[model samples]
Target: MPLDQIPDEKEMSFLDHLEELRWHIIRSLIAIVVIAIAAFAMKDFVIGTVILGPSRTDFWTYQKLCQLADLIGTPALCIDSLTFELVSRKLSSQFMTHVSVSFVVGLVLGFPYLFWEIWRFIKPGLRPQERKASRGATFSVSVLFMMGVLFGYFMIAPISVRFFSTYQVDPSLQNLFDLSSYINTVTLIIFGCGILFQLPVIVYFLTKAGIVSSALMKAYRKHSIIVILILGAIVTPPDPFSQILIALPLMMLYQFSIVIAKRIEKREARQNKES
Candidate 1:
């Protein structure tokens, strides 16, 4: 086996494998760069509409909450009036935050392509049946990640913002946030949510490997909820309302993972019985 020969589908030596992986990584980086450039160009929209969206009273989520409140006749559900000021103390803070947020936006937008590139590299190593078993994995993961990000941004982040901005130790004290701090907090929340949303996928694979089962998850349901609550508290501000907001969706995801694990277990049982 020589080191020079590698043409997509042919057997590759160690060096050839490294070369292939390098190319895949290069392509993925290029995609992320292109997306970052696009995001950088749309600076005003990205900063004004997205990064600061949750901090505003008239944001879409708040408006929807108001409407829901009116419908349910619960005037208290109408979320409004965040009192806070975002300030940048350092000279380059704003520029640095702009670049950082743009890069994050790029990654979020290009997540599917980035993951596809990675899966392309890994898929070749798996057997045909194994690959077939994970058919649509890229799509499912990307969609769930986006859904979680949206939920965090539109729901959890806003609630946290509202709570912290409104909470007061004294009437004279004001809530002032650093520009970087605010953006970083929101970005981390969304990212954390995206990772948390992979519960079902993780459960599926663990079930397939016989490392986890529906019964085990059911037995530890209370523990899982407590963990989810802790995770919510870690990602969100130290407020019960915000913690509850993030925890609710995770609780649902956990329950859904149990169902997924159950189905997979039953299918395996049937297959083994037939054999």
Candidate 2:
């Protein structure tokens, strides 16, 4: 259909909007499946190198920690080994896990395109100024997501895995973990961080909608610190150092969100004055 022939959001009925949204969702799913198929083909590398990297003692994070330990003359940070094992109990557990992991990898890799499709569906409903204001939203969101994933994979996942794999409740028992559980822990932390890293983007939209202000965020700084510390404890190992490491970045992100909100407020004020 020509752009002129198609009805605007105001002219379209509720069912028409649903129909449009359905198509958008279908396209996004198709993109994910295509990418997932490719990921499945490279399962060996993805699963062996990427997914299971944190489980090994010689992993980059452990290596870095060892170096830091040497520099500081503290042997506590040096992790010589991971004292745990992964086993699959179900008949089809491995196969099913491979399939699920491929799909998740596809979703993470194709997030930018997925958001593009969603943005296309939403753009027509927005005013010209709104569209202009949201320019680069997809890129900004994608960058933040990737950064969070890397942080989780490189820093958070390894630390958590090390702590859990080594900490034994009893000396007589061995730490044996299910393969599915291990994968879930790794991916959950990765995707959770990826989503959490979008704090500034979330604040941007809220600020744009006049639902949030920088002053409010500033006033709530102390409360946010407490929340961040709790979140750090939840995501990280039960150690003060690990919790502080996680909380530091989150605190920075919160401060950055306040800056974003302030910029938006200033821009709106300037626009108002000009109008």
Q: Estimate the TM-score of every prediction.
A: 0.92, 0.92
The residue-by-residue lDDT of candidate 2 on 1-275, one tens digit each, is: 32223756448778877888888788899999999999899987889888988988878999999999999999998988899999999999999999999999999998888998888888877888888999999999999999989998998898889878878778999998999999988898888788878889999999999998999999999999999888877766677766787788899999999999999999899989999
The per-residue C-alpha lDDT of model 2 at residue 16 equals 73
**On residues 1-275, what C-alpha lDDT tens digit does candidate 1 reach at each position?**
21223344777678867877888788888998899989899998999988998888899999999999999999999986778998999999999998999899888888889898888878778777677768899998999999998988998889888887888999999899999999988998988888888888888888887899999999999999899999998888899988888889899999999999989888888989999
For candidate 1, the 10 contiguous residues with the lowest summed lDDT are 1-10
Clashing pairs in 2: none
How well does model 1 score by local distance difference test?
0.87
lDDT of each: 0.87, 0.87
Please list all clashing residue pairs in model 1, or write none if there are none: none
Show where candidate 1 strays beyond 4 Å. Answer: 1-10
